[model samples]
Target: MTRTLSIAIKENIYRELRKLVGVGKISAFANRAIEKGLGELEKEQKREKEQLRQQLIEGYQKRTKNKELQKTLQVYGEIPNERNEYSLSMVGLPLTTDDLKKFLPVEVYIENTPTTGLDKPSKILCDSPFTWNKGIRFKKRLGVVSKEIIEKVKRT
Candidate 1:
């Protein structure tokens, strides 16, 4: 299905097209060029649209994950630190301030709280299910706190 159409072009461009393709074959050359250019443009547009769609999907997934995290954090409540700073939840993990305080020493928990972005207790110590010291090393300030020092401290 071929339709006749009239269009104007720059004089220099028209002259170059006439010389390169010949005046008699200009229609064929122009038709082929237009088809090739339009195909490339369509392909580029499709790629761009797909990329945008993927980005939107990723963004939606992140928002959904964040909402779930907020709900989980609310269950643990806020933990009060020695410095009076409190954190309702920790990022990247579901561990709460009270959970961290259970295994960590009074002093070591205080030191690591700011670095780990979690809260700690002032003096209270509680029985923790975590018996190993390896899991409590959240930040650079994790050090061995003597049992005597931890026991001597009074609960606040």
Candidate 2:
């Protein structure tokens, strides 16, 4: 269900927005921009909450009963049911660099930080740097190359 919303803003700002996104797109542009701003604010709040959770986990690990944690896990409310004893790790997907590299050619280098691996510089046997996706665009070709590299490494 959708309801029409009416709100007022500065005339100059509204004019500028109209010029940028056009009148027909103002509602959608405003919605996306507002939601992105809200998402950033929520990310900071979540970061703080995660920090506190980490501290609690650290404190629990320091306990002498950390070794014999069956009853301790129960006391900490970690035992979810009669069978389960602990919580699972939350996964942020699309593979970490360390893991993803295993699927790629070793001659190719990947940027270590802020991992959009496809945007980073890499090379084939120190030939020249290129973007992961565009530079080394041949996945099928690289698979053969990678296997050869592995076989050579194993023999040596």
| Model 2, backbone clash pairs (residues 3+ apart or across chains), number | 0
lDDT of 1 by residue, 1-156 (tens): 999989999999999999999979999998999999999999999899767656755555565534442222221211223422222112221223455435554322333344333344332333221211111222233233344434443331
- lDDT of every predicted structure (CA atoms): 0.45, 0.42
The residue ranges of model 1 lying beyond 4 angstroms of the native Cα positions read 66-156
Give the best candidate by lDDT: 1
lDDT tens digits, residues 23-132, model 2?
89999998898889999999999898767666765565565354543131110101113222222222111212244344343334333223222333332332221221
Worst 10 residues of 1 by lDDT: 129-138
Extract clashing residue pairs from model 2: none
TM-score of 2: 0.38
Q: What's the lDDT for residue 106 in model 2?
A: 30
Give the lDDT of residue 71 in candidate 2.
Answer: 30
Report the number of the highest-TM-score candidate: 1
